[model samples]
Target: MFDSRHIQTFAEVVRTGSYAATARDLGYTQPAISQQMKALERAAGTPLFVRAGRGLRLTDAGRLLARHATGILSSIETAHGQLKAITRLESGRVRVCAFPAANATLLPATVARLAASHPGIRVELLEEEPPDSLRALREGRCDLALAHSLGDDEEGVIQVPLLDDPLLALFPAGHALAGSGRVGLEELAAERWIAGCRRCRGHFLAACARAGFAPDIAFTTDDTLAVQVLVAAGAGIALVPGTALPLLRHTEVVARPLTPALGRRVSAFVLAGHETAPVTALLLRTLSEAAKDLEPAAV
Candidate 1:
């Protein structure tokens, strides 16, 4: 009979594309990966892969076995998830991957609420960008992922809208628009801007473009705090989520709703089928509650 261990070994090797990566991923030695592959091949009575210079290619038989391996691995995962779900609240870890903006604002309160409600549920948090968060969902690295939608839901995740954080203007307290409760986007036409990730979400850039000006980025950084600090220091003005405003308060910065204001919607994601996990459901509930009192940054 094809053993579970053999099926897993084959899957890891294929998933990672290298024996070394499989070893690191599974926390096994390279020799152990080799041993498992040999045993799996012996069970199938055929060689599964042909070694190339630094990589290996699956044979036709290997490809056929891989097809079966997928189902086998998925079944095993389902069984394990079921067990975890049944026992999770009593003693287990819930992993969450969140984006930077959430990290600054709603996330801390949400996590605190969950911890207070369910002390037994050990929750581990990871800060990842949208695609990385979604990848964690697909690859089983995280139970729940908090991320913003880039307007495309192509990752096949089950996404639940968490809350909307309006995009706001972030600038030094003394900047021209600081005293205004809100300012029109078009008013900042010629100001130097502190850009967010250009490669990922075009939201910040798009907002500027729609406002009829292209930002001359004085600096670009992904760390939300750093972005705020730079703007506070008068390095440049930035457009940021309302969530980020609270974190930037001590720096004497100001945040105001933009005219034709845009909001970057936050969402929680789980792998399509594993949405029923108790910890995930509870945390989602907690996040919703936390968002209610989130007054956006007062400044």
Candidate 2:
């Protein structure tokens, strides 16, 4: 049987395209790399690499083995992680990613609750946008990612809905529409707008399209506090997420529900089979319970 180390070296060489580079990456000498390659070839009973020009190239057999090696390495890593988690469910580490607003509002409460219930479980949190959060989950950089879906559902990921956070209109206290209670997107079409990030801008445009008019963005920003400050100073109106309300330090800005509510559907994503991890299950429960108070009341 080929040693795992030898197979790993072969994979690294395949990836790096040079035995010298792979050796540098893996902390092995050039001779050691050669020994590993030779041993792997011996175990396979065939030469895996062939000299071509100034560099080496993989044989057809080598290419086939490299494809299988990726899955094998991934499985080994997953098994090791599972074993570590299972052996210490309460004391294990759970790495999580969340968008900024949720990290500020809901996640802190959930983390507090989880710490109270499972003090030994070390939960590491990463703040990222929805796209980055999903990427982290796909790459196994995080155990759970709290993300907001605009429309697309990620394949190979299991998403558990936590809550719906509506986009509300933020107006200066003395603005004519401030006291309207609720307003339609059409009503604000002519008003100068404070734009958010790319995702937020997309949602804003989508909402406007539904209302039959385009918005004229006067300024663009993604900082929650900056958006509030700009809106409060009468730079422009904005559609801010409900979860971001808590982050607004200015009382000069008021949030009113939209005529036809448009918003993000927040969910927690985990790798297809990773939801079974004891810590993941526990944290999911905690997050769900914490989100209960954030949901809108039935009309």
Candidate 3:
């Protein structure tokens, strides 16, 4: 059997493509890495590397072993983490790729609770739209992503639904609808509409179309803040998530629920099966509980 160190060295060499680069990464001499690889090759009874001009390359057997070695190393690391967590060292890192709206409300309390409960864990917070966030999650750039849905795309991910975010109409405060608790989509459908989400903006527009008018597209932007700013400036009106309500600046903007209410479904996602990691599990539980705990109060 190849020694773990030798296996690691071999993997590193395969990863970097050159013994010298592996030496730089592992803080070892090139000769040392070469020796380790040679030892690993001997143990496997195969020539694991092929000499190439100015660098080294993995043979077929080397490529196969490298793949397995990478997995084995990861499993060992996770196992070590499990053992540490078993001793109350509850530790690891988790990331959240979420939209700014959710981050403003949900992430603060969730992370605070996490810090209090598991000081050993490191948490990273990022703001991204659902589509972008899910893409990041799939690319392994983040461990978790908070995404919004309109009751669609629930496939291919482990989703934990958070809340049904009430959709609201945003308008300049002194506008006719400010004091109105809710406005029908038709109320502003003919008004100039500066919107968000080129890809999904049609959903909101289509909802309006169902009410008998097409919105006048005055402008389009992705930044919710910018959208709200323009709306506050009387640039146009927008249908925005109520979760984004708290961040609206000034009394100039009033967010009132829309009648015939269009609400958005929000959810958290972790790559399936990866939810088992202790750190990820804690985050999932705490986040779901936080959402539940806030829902009634916020309602």
Q: List TM-scores for all candidates, in order.
A: 0.68, 0.70, 0.70
- Output the better candidate (1/3) by TM-score: 3
Order by TM-score, highest first? 3, 2, 1
Model 2 per-residue lDDT tens digits across residues 59-154: 998998999999888888888887875666647788999988888888888888878877878889898887888898888889999988636767
Give candidate 1 misplaced runs (Cα > 4 Å): 1-88, 295-299
lDDT of each: 0.79, 0.86, 0.81
Answer with 2 or 3, whichever has the higher lDDT.
2
- For lDDT, the strongest prediction is 2
Worst 10 residues of 1 by lDDT: 290-299
lDDT of 3: 0.81
Task: Give the better candidate number (1 or 2) by TM-score.
Answer: 2
Query: Cα lDDT of model 1 overall?
Result: 0.79
Error of 2 at 14 (Å): 46
